[model samples]
Target: MPTFKKNQSSTPKINKDNLNMAADAFKESLVNIRNSKTLHYIQRQRKKISENRSASEKYTEFVKKGQDKPRLRDADAPKTLQERGSETVNRFVKYVKHHRKPRDERAVRHINPKHLLWVLGGICLVLIILSGVNERFRAPFRDAASIVVVPIQKGINSIGLWLSDRIEAGKTLAQLEEDNKKLKEQVENLTMTVTSLRQKELELNRLQELFQISEQYTEYDMVAAHVIAKDSNKWFSTFTIDKGTNQGILKDMNVIASGGLVGIVIDAGPNYSTVRSIIDDESYVSSQFEDTSELCMLKGSLTLMEQNLLEFTDVSADVMISLNSALITSHVSSTYLPGILIGYVVDYQLDANDLTQSGHIKPVVDFADLQEVLIITKLKETSD
Candidate 1:
């Protein structure tokens, strides 16, 4: 009967509040375990051991320590070069063996990079001080350093010089190219200026010649004009002038250039006028020799125009005209003015009719090249 009775007090009470309190306590314990200093120390130690076990990391540490305290060679030291070399080899083998073990098992400790720099600077300072105090050690140390560093310094200097020279050469080449372009432009401008000056000079010369011709005919009222156009032929046989009725130019007005008679204005317009020179096929002039006063006829011929000559005919057979006689416009001419020099006579012979003489005469004007002219404004007066 006693075993069968349930013990209510012995059973534990279960509730939501107690379950929540228990869960809170368990979470706080886990947080404390995660943030424990002992656990952090163990993790750091494990990381250091892992790093120490690395052969490359251990070798780096060993080399860093060796550079920390560079010792000067003592003159009285009994240790020979072979002993030092064997010691270095043995120490390297020991470091290799220690790299396979844990961090606590190795004798070497990790050094900071900043400490290595300070150690290197201190060693350099010590060497400099010793070299200053001891002259005997200074020369040998300097010589040994020069043996390794001098060639490297000279090579660096040579490379720097070569680079500097290349840069200067590049700059010089660019400057030369720019200067050459500017020089070419200058040359082109100079050439154009020279050409313009030459053209102006030629124009000046032509104007001077026309001025002289104008002076020669001071007795007559004249107007200067430029030849604007001409016939398709090579000669200035039939041409047009810049002057017209607007300039008081009229038909039959005499045009002269280059020290001789050029043509007569045949048609006049408002702004332009046409002229027919003596070299044309239909042209003729009553003429006479200036020295002899013998009457003759000057006739134009296109065929003889190539030779720059006109034919003189109707000379009396007994006129006795000589070669190179000065031919002039006779006063008896109805259209032409009196005493205007026309041409010179050449090789007169008896015509087929035998009553007259015929020959060629060279005109004074160069018809092949005509530019300007003088127009005699006064027409020849005719009496009834």
Candidate 2:
């Protein structure tokens, strides 16, 4: 609501009394207008004159306030409120046209903030690239990584190399150890074989020495002969030697044992010879007592004695003989030495040609164990 402000310059109570008087006068004038037509005409003409004067006064007031003059002919345009508001709206539009609004609050075009940001970033990147061409401006991220991550990478690389080297070394060590084990086993086996070979060499040396001592009898012309064959049925009675008539060995040659006479060479060939032991039939050797001068003859009698024994026949039956008396060759032996050692007489006999009792005579020479021998070469020729 618009409050009407009093115009202080106006007369207060007098103006009010004058207004009442004018109103009363206007009422009288209206009554007169109602009473007579000529009076009414006269009153209307005065009222018209008063309205023209009021119009003139209002037009003068608009002119004094710098407002457009109200034309009575155009009064119908200000009838509606929209029409009445047009003059004020037109005046405001004209003021805006002459004086522009502040530029800060004004719209320019349709804006895309994201696209603007991209354009601005592109410009900054171009500037940065141009600056990087100087070879001085580096990426900040690269500098930071060099400060924090380079040492770690180097450590990882070193650890990988170390582990790889260790693995290779371990494999090499294992292979070497295995090779060493094999070499050790080979060396041990070789050492054992060497020891066994040395022992065999010692045994062969002993056999050679024995062979040398057995060869000392050069007078009899003893020859080295290997035992080639053995008679299985007459194991202790016969055996074959590799030496024969071709080697100066003959039939009935004396075959001496390691200590004394053992048998006689009987069968002879070009390259082989057979020996009949004293324990066999048809074998004989003249023997004498070692302690006395009594003479005897060795005879083979398998029926009278057991295996590996012989007999001294035709002795005096009452004569005594020792159990281990040494017996040897007598001077009466024409084919053998007169005093070459034969063996000990274990049992014997003495006789007066037919009354002598005979028993077994264990020979000192073990005929079955003879490996080598000496053949006597000096003997009487066969008498014609």
Candidate 3:
């Protein structure tokens, strides 16, 4: 009997840990219940019912206002849920609307797409047949189509032509630019060729003149030489030739050019020789008229040579010298060869002494520009 008594001390006591575990289990059960599909379906049903109730309320209000039936979408103004679900097979059936007019008993049938296509094809076939049989049947259709199609076709053609013209213009411009470049190159080449030809022509003319001079003095053995240097002045009054004692050129040797007597060598080296021209102030030559043996003294004057003239003094007053009289070296000259032309008498005047005359003479040689000259190898002494 004592053992059977309840053990009060062994009874389990409640604690915070146990209470917290019980609370967590209760909250997890609540979350699971809330997330269940059945609960979500119930919520959706409640929302749909509310929406339907509001739509019905709106419809009732509209009816109470005594207005004609208001237009409403099926989703916005649905009928009773039971009625909508009961007619599942009805959704697949074609709907026939009954007209409220005089033909209320007849149902208005909608047009089927397949039937409409068939009808259009039949009509087109009939038109094609009739157009082939008669011109009148096709005329109206063709004219009507052209009224729209012709303008469109013409517009397209105009655009095509404009684009083609632009392309052609661009091509033409490129072609012209190329041609212009070629033309410029051709012009440059032509200019160079003409310049070279001009130089050659000048050389040819100079050689011709030298040839003629050589013919004029065929009696003397002459050596051709080029002028190598000259004084700084414009005239070749004193110039060096590329000939000296090595070439049988000696001091006092006579020099001649294209016209006549040029000068006499004043200094001679082994390779070069200097000549003082007739225009030199210190130059003097015994001379006489070509036709007459009357002697005259030809003198150089720098001042008168400016006018391409020299001085002729010591001429006897009785001499028959006139303008343009030919003057030549006299045989009595110690240095110059005999009968060599010097110049022409351009002017003369009786000297103050009344025994002699003086005048200006234009020399045959151009001392201002001398390029080539001839040296008679035979000296005046040897010639004598």
Q: In model 3, state the lDDT of residue 113.
A: 77
lDDT of 3 at 278: 86
lDDT (10s digit) by residue, model 3, range 207-278 = 979786553334788889877667877544797676666789877889998758888987666556778988
Q: Quantify all predictions' global Cα lDDT against the true fold.
A: 0.76, 0.67, 0.74
Show pairs that collide, candidate 3: none
> Which portions of model 2 miss their true places by more than 4 Å?
1-219, 303-307, 318-320, 349-354, 381-384
Candidate 3 global CA lDDT score: 0.74
After superposition, candidate 1 runs with Cα above 4 Å error? 1-218, 233-236
RMSD of 2: 56.9
**Candidate 3 displacement at residue 29 in angstroms:** 99
Alpha-carbon shift of residue 258 in model 1 (angstroms)? 1.7
TM-score of 1: 0.43
- The number of the candidate with the highest lDDT is 1
Task: Give the Cα-based TM-score of candidate 3 against the true structure.
Answer: 0.42
Where is model 3 poorest over a 10-residue stretch in terms of lDDT? 96-105
Ranking, TM-score, top scorer first:
1, 3, 2
Q: Is candidate 1 or candidate 2 better by lDDT?
A: 1
Error of 2 at 13 (Å): 99
lDDT of 2 by residue, 1-384 (tens): 223334589655434444445545655656645557566566556665555444335445545665665676476557778876897799899898656734433565445788889999998897689656753343443356444654464456457667867887777777989989999999999999999999997887798797875532335556766555567764246877667666888777787777677777766665567788777776778878878757888887656335567778766666677778877877677666667677666665444466775556667677656666677765544454
